[model samples]
Target: MNIKKYILSFFLLISLSLFSQEVAEKRDAPKPEIKISYLDSIKKTFVRDDLASCVDSLWLKELTDLDLYNNLSQDIQTINFDEQVDYELPTEVLKARLQEMDEKSPFHIEYNPGLENIIKSFLKNRKRAFERLMAISEYYFPLFEEALDKQNVPLEIKYLAVVESALNPKAVSRVGATGLWQFMYQTGKQYGLKIDSYVDERSDPLKASEAAAQYMKNMYAIFGDWDLVLASYNSGPGNVAKAIRRSGGQQNYWNIRKNLPKETQGYVPAFLATMYIYEYHKEHGIKPERAPIKHFATDTVMIKKQISFKQISDLIDIPIAQLQILNPSFKLNIVPSYKDQAHYLRLPQDKMAVFTSNESKIYAYVDREANLREKPFQIVRPIVPQDSINTLQRLAQAKVRYYRVKRGDNLTTIAQKYDVAIEDLKKWNNIKGNKVAYGKNLRINGTDVEQKLSAVAKVEVDKKAVIKDSLGSKMDSFYVVQKGDNLSAIAKKFNISVADLQEWNKLTNNNIQLGASLQIAKNSIKEDVVAAPERKDIQYVVQKGDNLGNIAKKFGVSLDDLKQWNNLTTNSIALGSTLIVAKNEIAIVTNKAPVASFKKKEEYSAPATEYYVKKGDSLYSISKKYPGVTISDLKKWNNIKDEELKPGMKLKING
Candidate 1:
């Protein structure tokens, strides 16, 4: 009996120890922290009228105008209201249909009377518009889906494009938002969309979709809520934040709707309504019209030389309008060519074989046409009647003068100085922004006020001449650094290279101080023989689309060697400028000119790493993956003049 009691006591002690250990483990474990969503963070920082400033008022008006939709579909017949049974469905049935769609879609398709009315309007009265959108969707939705998929964003986001641009690649909002994605100039540049004289990549379906996907992904990362993402996209994040604050710290989109901008409040509903109509158009007796081009009907090829759309259309017997539709990115109908980069040309899939076979002939035709147009076409204006000559002479003669910008000066201040409007100043100088730099040259038209000040200016001019004469001829040849001057512009102005400017000034960076003196001449000595005897100034008139690389190639010189001799920091050169091309003082006797060669193999320090190109990859984008690799370096390494990258193509990324 004593042995049994001791065994029971031992079992009880073991149970107590195990229970105590479990309690200790539980106490030591970490408690999960309260996580705050992005919307909540925005609520804390929201302010009134913060986003209203960025939104374009005209764009808002356009969004709310129902007639725009009708006008967009004038070619199609409008659906008769009495014809479709679904259009006459009771509110209860419509709500149930929306509920069913909401349950099926990944997106939150919230139902309300406002959303229902929009859906009804689209289905009943605007059937033609809906049909047109459906037809265009066949061509554009696949591109959008591909881009969104690469970004890991929801496929439903494709509907946003329909609301933004109605599937028009060349759509532009009144506030200067351009292309399918409706990007402003600054935003487009920030997203790597190139806008230049010849090309506007923001209008290219493929490129714009990629930029849009990236933008949406960035917005989603910040807001976390897809509804809020849509609102922020329409009204900007600042306004959304402000709305959240005004709504008493509400993070939900519907709760903050009252505080949001009028357009933003409707933007989400429109997107949802568009989504619903697109998904259930057949149920509403709406049929999609046949699209001109199918998603897979087109193919892309890289063009090595600059070519015009007219040239391609004329040579290939393709309609110019169709070419324009297929390739809307080429502004002015010109495909831009650069020395180190190539442009892409899109053609119908069936025409690819013909295009490839006749590539040489097509390029030759373009060159011949270009040569023919080299001589200026003189327009013989009908001789103006002698009676009109006096009236023409009586018209005010506009005088032009160059003004130097000073420190602490802005466009407004400069405009005030010239007694001209700021808008006029911007127009004259091609100035896009308000900020002006010190020591920049501005062209000012002589106003009546300036004419009044001319006598005073003459005195100042005389004083300046005296000061200039005091300086020796060598000093007189130097240029004073201006407020708006950059190395490239300065080099272009003085017909010298940025490298030369830096060497003369001992500048470590591109920054130049205002009023600083820079030597413009190659030799300090007045005598021409003291200058490098090997160097000769050659006048090369820059043709349309010509670049420094091409010029260097034509002259049988290395790009770097050309830059060093010319003191150039960038490859940009002004048209019709004489550049110093340095050659050996001793002439080499050879029948053939020396061909440019690559640098010694040892000079390439980076190891070659192979990378397989993926969808949406360009030479410019791919170069960003490897350290120390540049687009130019990639082109040189691969013998690639065209910037296009194909999926599954292997490239060497030297790093």
Candidate 2:
């Protein structure tokens, strides 16, 4: 009985220890963190690396918050990448989002050999660009998600940007669609995107996302089908609507795909392919190579004056490239004033304190020094004085501020100087001309009452007056040449018919080489095209005593004409060696005599006995007889047009 009890006690103790260990193990076990996953069959099947190296291929699996946040170092600590992923997607939320997308998207899966080949070609050409796409994704994706959510659009459609620009913010397409979202200028304007000198908000990830969401929402109202909506976004609603009509009002994107433009034909497929790649990046071995993005950790300040990236770089010793990445809208490296005529300046979070401290100094520096270097990827200046003020309106009374027009003044320059527009200046001043004379006082800003008052009162307050010549006419038009520019676009800018431009430029066919100068219109100013003075066929060099005036008179040419012909950037000529005075076939013999005898005489006569002035001659020529007898002394002796003299007129010789 005693042995049996001891054995039972030992068994009970052993069971209790086992139960305690199990409890400890349960307590120590880590709770599973939920992660989203998608199968990537293409990557898995095609990537032929060894199984041992598969871990290297498992990009998404290996991805950490730091990996996602690599591009945004300044804000790395603030962004909770894992938290965003950890945030559970409610079934209802997923269902609603997906359902809305299905109702509005324009993409459709199709098997077309032509489209397939295009995709293949694009994929092959843009394989390396995927890294850029990945880095940019972090910046754009969250903004797109928020916009789509607010508009009740499908979040998946956010991938549309990849299809549009490969996530390159400054991407400009052949059709003139710009920014990552690929908004045409007109469409971008319609969506309330600002596109001017300093900023094209269409390229701003946040702003473009908002515009895209609203556009997608609008498209949904038209198609009521997500695929059709997407199709509309790619090819535009008019094209999609036409395609739908051509397809007998079919609501399907696939049915309407055939009616789309060639690019649009592949657009949907490319979007789908992009979505597939993003979803299964791990399987495809297309690991995203995240470039370090400094802007991820940044703060913005409103700049009231025109500021340049170079100013920021110089002040903070930051590279211009860094500032450019942070502020993409600045065309020509200048940040345009915001809606309040202030510019939004972005700086790294750590540097924000430093930037704020030097804000006044920075602004002063920028204002004081106008010769700052520009960022490479900055926007091209579409209009002259793009970063300057828009002088489209004139100054009115209460709103008017005085501005002095400087040298090289014009309506555009004055307008830019005051941040107004030329058109506005014209309207305000009721002036038809775009010229602003130097030293001209301009009413740069004022109210309508001030404009009326100034006009009625003819207020001529003591200010430098602009001298309007009223002599020259305005240029008919101008054209900006782009890469691969053809005659068609050039013709459009001048407002004269394309046929006229072709005829004006003597382009026999539509073909024209890039950078080739072409005349757009007859020049309004009839400036004399001074023919290069005729070079003498006979050779003559300066003897020690010979001067230009004597040599020119002997050669039967003007001194000015000799100065022009010898390829001289200056007036001085070499004593010996032949110059291309005339073509070899053309021999020039002066009506007076050949200059060879005069050139042969090495000995100099003390000076001329006397001098005579011929037609179109001047006292300067007569004075050449006496060393140091300037035209001034000659003019003092004669009642002349200063030095001017008529032919056969005698002058008193001082020699």
CA-lDDT, candidates in order: 0.65, 0.55
RMSD of each: 31.3, 29.1
Which portions of model 1 show Cα errors greater than 4 Å?
A: 1-87, 375-655
The residue-by-residue lDDT of candidate 1 on 1-655, one tens digit each, is: 9999999999999999999999999999898898975434433442322111122334223223335433433312232223333457578877787888778766677667666665666666668777767876787889999999999988888988877877777777767777777788888999999776678999889999999889889988988888898888888889998998898888888889889887677677778878878877777788887665676888899997888887776565566666666788888987867655578988776565567766766676667677778342111111221211211111112135567776688888888876789988888778898887665668776443233222222222222333344454321235567668888887766556789888887889898866566665543222111111011133234545657787666555589987887789998887755565434321111101111111111232434567788776678556533323577878887878788778999887553
How well does candidate 1 score on lDDT at residue 522?
Answer: 42
Q: What C-alpha lDDT, on a 0 to 100 scale, does residue 402 get in candidate 2? A: 63
> Across residues 406-525, which tens digit of lDDT does each residue of candidate 2 receive?
557778767776667778787755677767665445665444323332222211110001111123432222233556787876654444577888777677898875435566655421
Instruction: Give the least accurate 10-residue stretch of model 2, judged by summed lDDT.
Output: 458-467
- Residue 218 Cα positional deviation in candidate 2, in Å, after optimal superposition: 0.8
- Residue pairs clashing in model 1 are 437-483, 438-483, 439-482, 439-483, 440-483, 440-484, 497-567, 498-567, 499-567, 500-567
Error of 1 at 203 (Å): 0.6
**Candidate 2: regions farther than 4 A off:** 1-132, 294-296, 338-340, 367-655
